[model samples]
Target: MKIKSAEFARGVTGNDYSTQDNLPQIAFLGRSNAGKSSVINSLTGRKNLVHSSKTPGKTIEANFFCINNLFYLLDFPGYGFAMRGVQERNKMVKRIFWYLEFTNARPKVIFLIIDAKVGLTDLDLEMLEIIKQNNHKVVIVANKVDKLPQTKRKDKILSIVSQAKGLEVLEYSAKTHEGKENIFKIIEDLVK
Candidate 1:
């Protein structure tokens, strides 16, 4: 799908709110600083379309972006940040669950981002479990893959896929636009 235009539509905080016109949505999920924002920006061909934070736990809301007037790309708040207190952490998790389970217009596909260098952390697995429980379609994305050598890329991807239980896995380097087509192709298939 050619990204003719991508723009920020709105930011959502709670699940009680209504979604955007019942369009097919593909939400981005990942830990803080895991390159969720970067991947969104890269996929839409709009640099800085999504705000990436140097400090983790900054995006406390679920942001929605409209892509080429075709579908909605929801940018969910990051999980697994250390600075958050227990209460804040719980709230974040609750919000994530609410969006995944309670929302009526469930996402067509979920782009679960993970840091390529770190591989799959325990938090990532937990998130995947929640996605499975909610019966949401997921695509395990290993972000920041540009940091790894070309030869190691396939190996790392294979390892991550082996670790994940069911979701289809794809590697993306937001910095270099590597694997951009693969990600979009998956999304296109899901949305269509």
Candidate 2:
């Protein structure tokens, strides 16, 4: 998608995200350090549009970025981090679940990001269940494919497919900009 204008809209916390106007939103969901912000920056074609931190679980709020002034790209707070206090982590997880299950502003699609090298984990499976329970269409984004060897790409994708029971998976490399356009096409088709 051509990013004519990508700007920060707002950050949401708790159950009162109703301040946001209705717009087609595409949410990126993942564990801490899974590169949600990096993927957003790459998709928007702006290097620093979304601030990326070297630390894990830095994104505390549900961030909204308006893309092309037509739709929103929500960077959900990363979950499953050990660094955060148990209370804090539970709060974040609850917020994510609430947003996905209870919010009126359902996203057009939820892109569940998985680290290509690390593969899927229990938390990822839990997230998949949450999205599925909400009856939301989800697309798996196998991120950091550039870190894996060329020969392992297909196997990695196949493994995910096997586990997901035929879920749509797209590979992406925020560092190399690989498979970025495919994600854009999916978003464009959904938002249309």
Instruction: Give the least accurate 10-residue stretch of model 1, judged by summed lDDT.
Output: 14-23
Per-residue lDDT, model 1, residue 136, is 88
- Worst lDDT run of 10 residues, candidate 2, spans 14-23
Query: lDDT per residue, candidate 1, 1-192, as tens digits?
Result: 798888888888766536546678998999888988888988888888988878888678888898877889988788888688878887888899888888888889898999988888988888888889999888888898889888987888788888986668787889999899998888888777
Q: What residue pairs clash in candidate 2, if any at all?
A: none
Q: What lDDT, from 0 to 1, does candidate 2 have?
A: 0.88
Name the Cα RMSD for model 2.
Answer: 1.2
**Each candidate's lDDT (Cα)?**
0.84, 0.88
C-alpha TM-scores of all predictions: 0.93, 0.96
lDDT (tens digit, per residue) of candidate 2 on 6-114:
9999988868655346779899999988899999999999999888889998888899999887899999889998678888888888999998899888888999988
Best by the lDDT measure:
2
